[model samples]
Target: MPLKMDAAALNAFLDQAFEQVADDFVVEDVATDRLTVRLEVSDKHLRPGGTVSGPTMFALADVGAYLMTLARIGPQALAVTTNCAIDFMHKPAARTDLLGEVRLLKLGKQLSVCDVLIYSKGQEPPVARASLTYAIPPQ
Candidate 1:
């Protein structure tokens, strides 16, 4: 299916609907079943050990999946996370941004599921992985 929204449109929707965090995330790429998002790291995202915090990584995965869903389903601000599971495999590099690669596992009428892999910018191995299920509100 053709995309309902592209990277620029998704980014604009994020800015208009969620201004507080809009700048933190960048919708890097979008396709039929996948998306790439980047999280610009800052001091607020770091933990005591200087690695990216768990919550920060979770946000990256969650946001990546959410945006990927919206890209195909249109800008649905009410689309909510019904479930999420995250695995932190390795310590993310300090001072590096995080990148999330999201792939749609399922997209039905009422729900969309996605798998996300997060990596530290410039790193090869994934630092975290997540599976998310989102509830799409009826139009």
Candidate 2:
């Protein structure tokens, strides 16, 4: 599919949807092949050892994939995740920002696939990586 949405439009859509759903995440920046998203990690996002929680990382991956799909398909709000597999590679810092770098691997009529690599801000290595699949609802 051709590019139907730019970074600004994607950010606005995110603000209206997921951003409104929760204030912890913000769409920081996006490009034709990559998306930079940040999660304002807090105590609520942490697990027992002060590392970012798995669920939080999973949410980031999900939203990151959704944003990537919307960038190609335009503001199709009904597009939803159908499958996801996340790997927690390393522990993320406590109370720090988590940056998700998302790349859309495929976008078809009914399906979209993406890969997300998440890292804590100022950290050299990534904390998690995920592969996600989304179903694009027909209009």
Off-target runs (Cα >4 Å) in candidate 2 are: 19-22
Query: With candidate 1 superimposed using the best TM-score fit, by how many Å does residue 44's alpha carbon deviate from the native?
Result: 0.7
How would you encode candidate 1's per-residue C-alpha lDDT over 1-117 as one tens digit per residue? Answer: 689999999999999999999999999999999999999999999999888999999999999999999998998899999999999999999989999999999999999999999
Model 1 earns a TM-score of 0.98
TM-scores, one per candidate: 0.98, 0.90
* True lDDT of residue 113, candidate 2: 91
Task: Give the least accurate 10-residue stretch of model 1, judged by summed lDDT.
Answer: 43-52
Runs of candidate 1 with Cα error greater than 4 angstroms are none
Candidate-wise lDDT, in order? 0.95, 0.85
Clashing residue pairs in candidate 1 (N, C-alpha, C atoms within 3 angstroms)? none
For candidate 2, give the lDDT. Answer: 0.85
Q: CA lDDT of 62 in candidate 1?
A: 94
Which prediction has the highest TM-score against the true structure?
A: 1
In model 2, what is the error at residue 85, expressed in angstroms? 0.5
What clash pairs does model 2 have? Answer: none
